[model samples]
Target: MYTANNIADFFLGRYAAEGKITPMKLIKLVYIAHGWYLGLTGKALIDENPEAWKYGPVIPSVYHSYKHFKNSPIRCEHDSEVTTGSEIIDKFLDRIWKVYGKYTGTQLSAKTHMPGTPWDITWNDLKDRNRSSLQILETDIKEHYQQLASKNANG
Candidate 1:
C-alpha cells in the first residue's frame, strides 16, 4: 500500500536530485501515464474527469487521429499505420520510473492495476479507501499538498 506521505517523499527526492519539479507536475505526469494506460486498455479511471483526458492520456491518440484525418490529402498514411494503439497503453510500472528517473534508498511502487482508478471507482469504494470523512480523492490530494508545504519548509 502506498501512502500519500511516501509518494510526496518519493517525488520530492526525485526532483531534488534532478531539477525543479512541482508536485502538481509530478502528479500530472503520473496521471498522464496512468490515464493513457487505462484509456487504451479498456481499464477505468478512478476519476473520469473527461476534461483531463483531453490533456494527457488521450492527447497523443487524439493528436494522431486529427492529424491523420486533417492531413489525409497530403499524407499517404491510413489509420492502421498510425494506430499502434496498444503502444499507448500504460506500461505503468516502467514508465513511472522513466518519468521520475531512478531512486536510491527506497524502492517505491504503485498498484497501477488496482481495483479501480479515479474514474472506474465507485462512490462507495472511494469512501472506503480514503475514509468516509472526505467525499473525494481530491481531498486527500489537498492534504498531501499541505504536508508537502510543511516538509519543504522544515527541510
Candidate 2:
C-alpha cells in the first residue's frame, strides 16, 4: 500500500503539465484512486482514511499540503516527483487518469457529493455531526466502490 501523499504526488505529477489540478481535485482524485484500487484488487492504494468534510471526503495531509494554493491551480515547489514503485499501481493510476483526467476540480467535487457516494453516506450518517472531520470508514469505501464496479460491469 502507498501513503496518501505518494498517490497525491503521482496525480500532481501527471497533471503538472495540464495546469488544471487543484487542491480539491487532487484530493478527490486520490480518494477515488484509493477506492478503485481497494475495490478492484482488495488492497488499499493509500494508507490514510479520508475524512468526511463539508466539501466531501478529504485526506488531511493532502488537503493541508495544497490548501495554501486555495482555489487556484496548484504549483507546488516540489511538484510531482512521485513514484508508487509498483508496476500495477502505476498502470492503475494511468487508467484512472485516462478515465477521470478530463474533469475539472469542481466537477470532481460534485461527483463525490452525489447521492449514495461514500462521502455522502458517511457525512449524512453522522449523529454527532462534526461535519468537517469524521473519518469515512475503509470498509464503507471499499463496499461502495465494489458496488459501483459491479453496477458498471453489469450494465
> Which candidate's TM-score is highest?
2
Tens digits of per-residue lDDT for model 2 on 1-155? 87898888888876667768888888989999999988887887888989998989899999998899998888854445456787778889989888888988889889889998888888887775544548888888899999989999999
By lDDT, who's the top model here? 2
Error of 2 at 139 (Å): 1.0
Error of 1 at 148 (Å): 33
Per residue, candidate 1 scores C-alpha lDDT tens digits across 22-104 of 33344444444434434434343333222222122222322332343332222222232221123332234335547444422
- Lowest lDDT sum, 10 consecutive residues, model 1, at 104-113
TM-score per prediction, in order, is 0.27, 0.90
TM-score between model 1 and native = 0.27
